[model samples]
Target: MENAENLLHKGVIEGEEGALNQFYYGYEANDPPEKQLSPPLKSKITGISLKRGQRVRLETPGGGGFGKSSERPLEKLNYDLEQGYVTETKDD
Candidate 1:
């Protein structure tokens, strides 16, 4: 048992919330076996236990952007799209 807090950070700008970390466990049988999933836990998690065949996965969130999206340069944004790091949308 352990106490983990502030698992996620807040975004600097408005409408920009940092991604929440995720924890997954268990197994499911399918064409390709898949791990059973659980919702992101934004707060503290305690008293977790695991069995012999069970597993746990921890997905950490990416860092928050520094400033406004509109302030980003077009060239860099274009490159992100070209390289599949970002996707183009009607809003842009």
Candidate 2:
């Protein structure tokens, strides 16, 4: 994906503050093997060696919100509340 600037706001806290890179996309296959799973940073990858009551699944995709977190930038929402990422509800 190579959008190393924490593109698409990877776990944003001011986009992880001056972030250099924090990509997330992963793989490995077969609960029944029809062979398909590859995205992000995959150029020539082919490695699947699992057996022994095999069962594997690791799918993750949800990190792209650029607005409406109260429309950010109160100094990045006080640095996401002093780096606890975010908290203070009770309709904060």
Candidate 3:
């Protein structure tokens, strides 16, 4: 048990993605015979959790190596106006 923890700690510290994956397998493989883990947690740990789509708008333009057009929805509208273009703004 301690050996497994040590291995997992090392893997995480070293950013070894594959080794971290193996650690999860090892965890279930070594689960005690009398105890059972719930399915949802296992699924989440394995990255199978339910996902919902989200719309993300960038918030700044031409900063940190971004293009002038790379601005948030509202910010982009402002940019367009500043650039002498017409754009419709969404209301929500």
Candidate 4:
């Protein structure tokens, strides 16, 4: 992944700013996969045997959000909430 940037607010990955790539690898049924930094862009594996249920997760870079959440229109916000894209938050 590359070219992921958000000016004001982040897109999905937390605490990440600008264009970056994130990679994760773990076996199935694991609660969470470990983050891999500086992973090779391409790799070739030979003679490696693997059991079933192995998985790898890759997050590609993408365009960042354009505006603030508070400034979003009510209708759009409501639609996002209803569609499970955004969750409702309570002010403390």
Q: On a 0 to 100 scale, what is the lDDT of residue 42 in model 4?
A: 39
**Model 1: runs farther than 4 Å from truth?**
1-8, 13-15, 28-35, 39-56, 78-92
What 10-residue stretch in candidate 3 is worst by lDDT?
54-63
* lDDT of candidate 1 over 1-92, digit per residue (tens): 22233444545764244455667765433323354656446466666666676766676666555577667899988887899755676342
C-alpha lDDT score of every prediction, in listed order: 0.59, 0.46, 0.32, 0.51
Instruction: Give the best candidate by lDDT.
Output: 1
Superior candidate under TM-score, 1 versus 3:
1
Q: Indicate whether candidate 2 or candidate 3 has the larger lDDT.
A: 2
lDDT of 3 by residue, 34-53 (tens): 44323322212444332244
Give the winner by lDDT: 3 or 4. Answer: 4
Tens digit of lDDT per residue, candidate 4, span 1-92?
22332223355433323334554554465544343222443333234333577666565554555556677799998998999755587444
Q: Estimate each model's TM-score.
A: 0.43, 0.26, 0.16, 0.43
Question: On residues 22-82, what C-alpha lDDT tens digit does candidate 2 reach at each position?
Answer: 2222223333344433334332335655555544454333454444566677898888889
**Which one is best on TM-score?**
4
Q: Please give the range of 10 consecutive residues that has the lowest summed lDDT in model 4.
A: 1-10
Whichever of 1 and 4 has more TM-score, that candidate is 4
